[model samples]
Target: MWKKPLKPVTKKAVKTKLILLYEDIVCDGTEGCKRHKLVGKKYFGGLYEGSERNEDLWLEVQQYIYDNYDTEYLKNVYIAGDGAPWSVAGCRVLEKSKFVLDKYHLGKYIYKATTHLDDSQQAAKEFIYGAINERDFDGVMRLLQKCYASTDQEYKKKEVTECARYIKNNWLGIMVRIDDGGAVWGCSAEGHISHVLSARESSRPMGWSKKGVDWISHLRVLTRNEQKIIDLMEYQDKKQRKKNRIECEDQLIQDVQKRKSSRNEEVLRKAIPGLEKKQFSWMRSIINAGGIIA
Candidate 1:
C-alpha cells in the first residue's frame, strides 16, 4: 500500500510493502486437516526498497531458513502468492520450491468472473475450478470467453476478460494444488498482512515516511518474534556509552559541576527544607559509587 511521505509535499507517497514467510506441515486431510494445525514457524520480512531490495529480502530469507530450519530433511517448499512476478521469482532463490496461487485471490477472481451468471454462478465456479484442477488453461479461457460473450454489460465483459487473464497467467500456481495432491492448503497472506503490518501501518488514517514504515516493520517483526524493544535499546545505549566512555564521563562531570554552580540551587534549597542540610549528598554518593556510569 502507498503511504504519504513526511517531507517534500509535492512528491508522491511511496509504496510500502511487507513480505512474510513461514513453514507449514499440512496433513493432507488424514490427520484432521484443520486450519490452525497447518501453520508452523512464521517470520516476518522487512520492506523492500532499493533497486536490489527483492534480492536482498530473498537472501535474508534463505539465510534465516538455513540458520533456523533443518534444510537437509526438507524435500519441497511451497511459495504461495497472488501471482505477482516478485512472488513467483522466489522459487528461483530457494531450491525445490513450487509456486501456488493464493486461494484468496483466486476466489476473488472467480467471484468476479461468475457473479454475472446469476443462476449459473455456482455451476460456473465448479466448472472453472475443475478446469484449473485439470490444468486446462485453454478450457478455462473458453469458459471465460463464453461468459464474456453471454454478458451484454460492458463491465461484465471486462470482469470476465480480467479473470481469464489472471487465470492464464497464474495457471501453474492454480494447478499446483492438484499437482501436490491437495497438500498446498492455500496462503494466508492477506490475514498475515492485516494482522501484522496493517494493524500499525495502514489501519489508521495517518501517513508514514518510507524510513518510518521500514523502522516500524522491523519493530513489529521483533515484537512478533518476542524480542523486547526496551532490551534492544538498552543494549545499544550501553554499547554506545562504552564506545565513548571518556567523553561521557567528561560530559557528566561538566553537567554536575554546572548544576552545582547554578543560581537555581539556592531556590531549590529554599523549596525543600532539608536541601542545604543534605548538601546534595545523594549526588556525591552516586559519583563515588560509580552509579552514574550506566
Candidate 2:
C-alpha cells in the first residue's frame, strides 16, 4: 500500500508509508513420475508443476486486509508479478492499486514481440526496449502503436495488439513510478517468495501442507524484520529471567518458535495495548527493499 496525502502535511507531521502485498505458489517440483528421454536414455521423473492459485490467494488476502484494516495510508500502491493469471487477477481486483509489469516478465514479452521484426521493425524494437528501460511508458506505447499500424503479418499484428492492451491497462500504475521519482522495474515479491518459500520447498522435498507452508511463511516474514527479531529476543530474555535465570533448552526452543510464528501486530497489540505507538519501524525498510532511496 502507498498513499499520497490529500493535502500537504504540516512541518510538524510528515510520514511516508508503503505496504507490500505478497503471495506464493504452492507447488512441489515433482508430482507423480512420467517418462523422459535424455541422451536417448529413457527414464522416469516426476512431472514438475506450479500452482495457479497463488495469485488468487494473494488477491483474497489483499481484499481481506483492505476490508479489515485502515488503508488510507496507501497513496500509490503497486501490485507486481510475473505473467501469471493470478498476478493479473490480483491487479484486476485491486484496480486502484498500481499494476506494474515485472521487468523480467516484460523482457520475455519484448523478446516474443520482436521475434519476426524486419530491419525497420528491428529499429522499432530497439526503440521500444530503450523506452521501456528508461521507464518512458508513453514512448513505448507510441512505438508499439506505430509498429502495430505498419506490421502486415496477422500474427505479428495480433501480438502487438495484445501487448498494447497490457501496456494500456497497466499504463497509469507504471507511469506513477516515474512521476513519484521511485524505482519501479523490479519485483521484491519474487525475491521474498523465492527466499522464504522456495528455499523451504527445496529443502523439504516432501512438500508442505497448506497450513505448514502458511505458518513457515509467516514465521519467515517475522524473522526477516529486524525489529521483530529484537522484540523476540527481548521477550525470550524476559521469559528466561522470570524462570529463575535457568535456561531450559527445550522450553526455550519452543518459546522462540512460538515467537517467530506469532503475528507482529498481534504481539505488539498484546504487549502494549492502546499504546498508540508503532513498534515495527523496520516495515518501511522492507517496503524499500529493492528501491532507490532518492
Candidate 3:
C-alpha cells in the first residue's frame, strides 16, 4: 500500500507543488479476447466519455485533497498517467502540477522499437531498458538515435522519432522517478487501473457510456481508499447532529441530499458567490464544512 517517496532532482525551475498520478481504461467483459472485442459483449457503463470519466475523477480527487489539506501539503506535484488523452488532460489541467509519463507506456514504445530486432540484439534492448530505468534522458535519446541510424530501413525512423518526442516532452517526469531513487515510480496508478478494469473488460461488451464506467471506477477507488469513506461518514454524522439541533427531519434529509449531490466547486461557487474571493478559498471552506462527506 505504501511506496517510497521520489527524491527531488536538481532543476533550476521550482518543482511542481503537488503530484497526482492516475490511469484509466474502458472495460468490456470478456475472458481472454485478443482485442477489446467480444461476441455479444455488453459495455460496462459510466459518465461523459470513458476518457472524460478519468479526467473528472482526477479533478474530483484533486478538489477533495485541496479542500481538506493544507496548500503547502505538496511543494511540487507530479501527475503520472498512461498515454491516454484523458490522463494527459488531467495532468495538464492541474494549475501547479507536472505531468509525468507512465514508465509502462514507455516500455511499450521500447518493445515496439525492438519488435523486429534479432535475438542477438537482446543486448541492445537491455541497453535501452537500462537507459530508461536509470532515467538517463540523454542516454535514452542517444541509444534510440543510434538504433534508428544504424538500421538498414528495417525500422521506420518516424516511429522512432515519435517515441523520442514523447520521451523528450516528458523527460523531466521520467527522470523524476530515476532521480528520486525510484521512489516515485508510476506503477501504482497503472496497477490500479489494470486491477480495477481488466477483469470487467475481459467479460463485458464494448461501447459502454462514459458515466457507467466512471461510477464503477469511482466505486473501485472508494473501496481501495476505505479510510476516505470512513472520514466522510464521520464528518457527515457530526454535521447531521448539528443540523438536527436546529432543523426538522424533512429539511435535514433534503440538506443531506443536497450536500451529497452538489459538493463540487462550481456548484458551491454558484450557491455562495462571495466565497469565490481567492482561487478556490470558498471551495476549500465548503469542502472543509463537510460538503464532501455528505
Candidate 4:
C-alpha cells in the first residue's frame, strides 16, 4: 500500500490518497520459487473524504483479510512495504504478520549511501546486499561505515549515516527477508500504486477536488475488482431511484388526494437521464473522474 499524493485543485489545497492492496501468492516454498499473479482486493481513500480515522482504516484492513482468508490456518503472512508507519502498521493489525522491508526502498537507501563511490558504487551495493542476504547486521553496518569514511564530502557522510539509521530501524524487517529465504518475493507495492492510483489520479497534468479524488479512487478499485463501469452507474441509478421513491411516497399520496398532478410522480416514471444525455456537464464530470473519458 502507498500514500499517493494528488494534484490539488487550488494552490492552498493539500490532498492525499491512500490505497490499500493485498494479494495472495502461492509459492512452492522451495529454494527455486515459482509463483503466479492472483486477483487482489483494493481499498482507496482520501485524507478528509470520509469520517474514518487512521485506526479505523487499519481495522478495516484486518477485516478484509479475515473475510478473504482463513486466518487461523495461515502460518505466515508477510507485509512488505517501504517502512512507512502506515505500511508497517499492518503487522500490528494482522495475526502472524511479519514486516519485510521492500527491496525498492532498501535499494534506494543503499544507492544513496554509495552515491559518493562513483565507479565502485555497484560493487559496494553487491557487498551490502550480500551482507543482508547472510543476515549479518554488523557486516552491513561495517560496509556503510566504509562508504562513509571513503567520502570526505559532509553531504555524502550524512547520506551514509541516514542509510545506516534507516537500516538499523528496519533491521527486523530485513532479517525477515533473510530468514524467509526464497519463500517471500520482494514487495511490488510501488508498481501496484502506480498502476492502481497514480496512473489515473496524479500521472497527468490536471487538478482534482477532494470529492473527485474520493470518487475516482473508489471507481478505480471497483474496476480492478472486475466491476464494469457501466454496471456501476446502473447500480447507482437504481439506488438513487429507490431513495427518491421512498422520499416522494408521502407527498405523492397527498397530491393524489388533492387531485393534483405531481412532478415527483413524473420524475419517478422516468429513468435517470444522466447516462443518456452526453451533453450534461455533471455526467461528463462523473465519466471523466479517472481521466479516461475522451
Candidate 4, residues 1-294, lDDT tens digits: the string is 566657545565555546455565556456676754544656655453333455566676678778888888878767777787766776777678788888788889999999888899999999999998888899999999899999899999999999999999999988888788643675667677788788987898777766677788778877876779999899999999999998799788876755533443344336455555656666545433423335
- Candidate 1: tens digits of C-alpha lDDT, residues 1-294: 112222334555554445556565555555565645335555555667654786676677778778877899987777777887766777788767888888888899989988988999999999988888777888888888888988899999899888988988888777777788644675667676777777887677777777787888778877877789998799889989887998889899999977765545555446756643467787545544444435
lDDT of 3 at 221: 47
Best candidate per TM-score, number?
1
lDDT of 3 by residue, 1-294 (tens): 111111233342111111223322333467664333212211111233455554555566577657655758665555565544454565555655655667777777776665556684678779987987876778988988876886576446766777788777767667666666433643444343345454443234343334454455444445544436667578889999988876787788888877766556456667876674677785677565655534
Task: Give the Cα error of residue 41 in candidate 3, in Å.
Answer: 31
Using Cα atoms with residue i matched to residue i, what is each candidate's TM-score against the true structure? 0.71, 0.39, 0.49, 0.67
Full candidate order by lDDT, most accurate first: 4, 1, 3, 2
* Shift of residue 84 alpha carbon in model 2, Å: 7.5
lDDT of 1 at 278: 66
Q: How high is the lDDT of residue 123 in model 3?
A: 80
Model 4: colliding residue pairs: none
Question: Which stretches of candidate 1 lie above 4 Å from their native place?
Answer: 1-13, 25-39, 234-294
* Candidate 3 accuracy as TM-score: 0.49
Off by over 4 Å in 4: 7-36, 39-52, 181-183, 229-294
Q: How close is candidate 1 to the true structure, as a TM-score?
A: 0.71
